[model samples]
Every structure is written in C-alpha cells, then in structure tokens.
Target: MFYKEIFSFIAIAITLAAFIPYIREIFRGTIRPHIFSWVIWGVTTLLIFVAQLEDHGGVGTWPIGVSASITIFIAYLAFIKRADVTITCGDWLFFIAALLSLPLWYWTSDPLWAVILLTAIDVAGFGPTVRKAYQFPYSESLLFFALFTLRNVLVMLALENLTLTTLLFPAVMLVLCILMMAMIAYRRRVLFA
Candidate 1:
C-alpha cells in the first residue's frame, strides 16, 4: 500500500519534471507542440484517468490526471502562441474520432470499451505530432518524451489493481512513448544526415 503510494507520487513528480521544462520550451519558442494533438491527448488522457479510477486504479491514476491538465494547458499555449495551429483535414479527422470515444464509451456503459476506444483515438492523435516531429526533428524535446515514458512505467508499477482497465492506458502509452522517442531520434539522425 505504502509503496504504491510512493511510486504514484514519484510518477507525478516525474511528470512535473518532464512537463515543466517542456512548458518552458514552449514559452521560449523552442518547442512547437501541435494544437490538435495536445487537445486530443488532453481529452483522452482525462477520460482514461476517469476510467482508471472506475476500475479501482487508486493512486496510479494521479499522474495521468495531472498530465491531462498539463496537456490541455499546452494546447491552450500552442493556440495563443500560434504554434503549429495548422488545421489539416487529417487533424480534424483525429479530433473528431477522439471526441466520438466519449459517446461510444457512454453508450457501452463499460470503462474497458472507453479505455480501448480512447486509447485508439489517443494513438491516432499522435499522427500530427509525429508528422511535425518528423519534419522538424529539432522542434521536440526527446528528453521530455523519455521522461514521459519513464513516468508511464512508474504509473504502471504504482497501480493498485492489475486489471486491464487500470493497465491498458499506461501500458499502451508506454509503448507509444517509446515508439515516439525512437521515431524522433531516427528522424533527427536522418534529417541531419
């Protein structure tokens, strides 16, 4: 019980560690976050956190809850700073798909389906940021993604319940973060080469 709580807090701390600098970069105009991606991520993340709590995830959901707010704030910052506000048709597709998850989740009356749908939408949400990172490898902070990956791992470890509902979101996010990090590194190398 105590260990789970500690791990949960540590994960939250890591989230802060990762996001504070990322936010600073945004303010400094060093990192250009895609508005659509952050908005989708924010909405999905908050919903996923609710699903986790419904599944008795307990303390593990804390980091995700914190991330949700930060993600939304980043989206707001992107909009205000006029960073990557380009609304591609595909971006609209991703956003709409993400919004649909909520109604689908409500209709199903199952947190699992919600997590699954939201996770898929969240994955799709990565498309714009992934494209941006591929085009301008220098615009993202790889370390932020790395820390986020680590934070997800910690979140998984801190989970009180080991059910799929509690585990799926962080598990998938962990994989996604790793893949994103890998793609960013490869893009940086290929672009500079």
Candidate 2:
C-alpha cells in the first residue's frame, strides 16, 4: 500500500511538473509545442492508468484517458497552428487553478467536498476557453469543452459515494450541452442569414 501510494504521488508530481512550464508559456501568450503538449497529456493518461492499476478507480480511468487524449490532440490541431488564438493569460490562470485542485482532491477524506470543489474549479477555469471556443467553433478549442463536460460528468458518476453535489455536476453538464448547441445554432443562422 505504501509503495503504491508513493508511486501514485510521484506520478502526480511528474505530471504537474511537466504541466507547469507549458502553463507558464500560456501566461506569456505562447502556445506550447504540439509535441510537448502531447507529452504532458500522455503523462496524464499514464497517471490515470496508475490510479486505476492501484485500484483508486480502475474502470473510470479508461474513459478519462480516451476523452483527454482525443481532446488534446484535436485542440492542438485546431488552435496551436494559429498564432493569434494561442494560449492566453486567462488560459493559464484557469489551467493552474484546475491543476491546483488536484492535490486537494487527493488529500481530502470527504469525497463529497472534493467532488464539489474540483467540479467548481474545473468549470470556472474552463469558462474563458469555452467562450473562446464558442466564438471560434471551427477551432479545436471547442473539443476541450466537450471533453471537459464529459469528464466532469463521468467522474461525478464514478464516485462510489454519490453525494448531492454529484448531481449538480451532471446538471451543469446538461446546461453546457444545451448552451453549446444553442450557440452553434445561433452562429449557423447568423452566417447563413
């Protein structure tokens, strides 16, 4: 148990370390290299593997990894190529905020509080990105929002102890889906009109 715990902690640390510099560049208004971004994401996927292998939550890991990998790849293809739409200061702020919540997630004994806090941070952090994605639907930025919403929903459901706040996460996800669909419809009408 001790070794597994330590390894889990180390894996988390490595992921965060790889993520920090990319995040710093986002603050400086520079997009990370697609390859570098992929590395970070790959590491994250691996983290999920370790988490599950250690029995932290095995079945849930696969969906999270698949969603994240697809989202990252699509996001890279869509936005990383455009200099003007590269990572911005707001993006970094949100990224860091989300990452900061992970330690809290690991440490908290109360699963309900952890879920609530993590869900809130994720949604809030992703808000700016989601707005930007909506404005530029053709860009890969849109993929992350979809993935983010999915991830939140899946994680909430995966929790063994279903809490009241878990319901809130899915409700929020439903609203996001509705809002995104509405935005797409509005944009299409505007363009065609």
Candidate 3:
C-alpha cells in the first residue's frame, strides 16, 4: 500500500516534470501544438482519469489527473499561439468524433468502453499533429513524448488493481507516444538530410 502511494506520487512528479519543458517550448513559440489535438487530449484524459479513479480508487490515477490538467493548459497555449499552419478538414472531423464519443461513453456507463473509445479518440486527435510534425519536426518535442511514454509505464506499474479499464488507456498512450516519437524522428531525419 505504501509502495503504491509512492509510485503514484513518483508518476505524478515525472509526468509534470515531463510537460513543463514542453509547455515552456510552446510558450516560447518553439513548438506549435495542434489545438485540436491538445483539446481532445485534455478532454479524453480527464474522462480516463475519472474512469481510473472510479475503477482503481485513485491508486494509479494521480498522474492521469495531473496530466489532464496540464493538457488543458497546453491546449490553451496552442490556441492562443496560432502558429502559421493550416488545420485540415480531417482534423475537424476527428475533433467532432472525439466530442461525440464523450456522450456515447457516458451513456454507455462502461468504464472499459469509455477507456477504449477515449483511447481511440485520443489517437485520432493526434492526426493533425502527426501531419504537422511530419512537415515540421521541430514543431513537437521528442523529449516530451518519450517522457510521457515513461510516465505511462510508471503509472501502469503503480496500479494496485489491474483491469481492462485501468490498463487500456496507458497501454494505448504508450504506443501512441512511441509512434509520435518515431514520426518526429523520421521527419527530423528527412528534413535535416
């Protein structure tokens, strides 16, 4: 029990530390995060955090709850910065789908389904950022995603009770973070070469 609390606090600290530099970069106009991506991430993370709290009784949810809060702040920064980039129609489509999924999950009242759907929405929301990162690799931070992957792993390890609802979101996030890191790396390689 003590170990679980320690792990939870560690996860929370690492998660916040990971985002601080990313947020600073965004504020410095070095990283131009997609508004749609951050917005969906904020909302979906909040939902997942709530589901995790209900399912795990806060054992492994502190990091997720903190992440959701930071995501909201980053989303606001992205919105205000308004980088010199265009938001494609497909991005809007994904955003709408993400918004619609929330109510559907609420209506279903299944934490498992909620996490699954939210995970899907969260990945879909990354579409625009993925596209943008492909074009401008430096527009995103590799360190942030890498640390997020680590944070997810820590959160998973910190889980006192593991279930589909508790595991799905972190697992999906870990994969997505890896994919995003790969995308950024590929873009950097191609752009610099």
Which candidate number maximizes lDDT? 1
lDDT of 2 by residue, 36-97 (tens): 33333333433433343344453333444454455365346435554334566666666666
Pick the winner on TM-score between candidates 2 and 3.
3
Model 1 Cα lDDT, one tens digit per residue, 47-101 = 8999989989999999999999999999899989988866678778777777766
User: Candidate 3's residue-wise lDDT over 91-185, tens digit each?
Assistant: 88888888887687787677888888888888888888888888888988899999989989988888877998998889899999999999899
* Rank by TM-score (best first): 1, 3, 2
Candidate RMSDs in Å, in order, are 1.1, 10.4, 1.3
Q: Which candidate gets the maximum TM-score versus the true structure?
A: 1
Count clashes in each candidate, considering only residues at least 3 apart in sequence or on different chains. Answer: 0, 0, 0
What is the alpha-carbon lDDT for the whole of candidate 3? 0.86
Superposition TM-score, candidate 1 onto the true structure? 0.96
Clashing residue pairs, candidate 1?
none
Candidate 3: how many backbone clashes?
0
State the weakest 10-residue window (summed lDDT) of model 1.
99-108
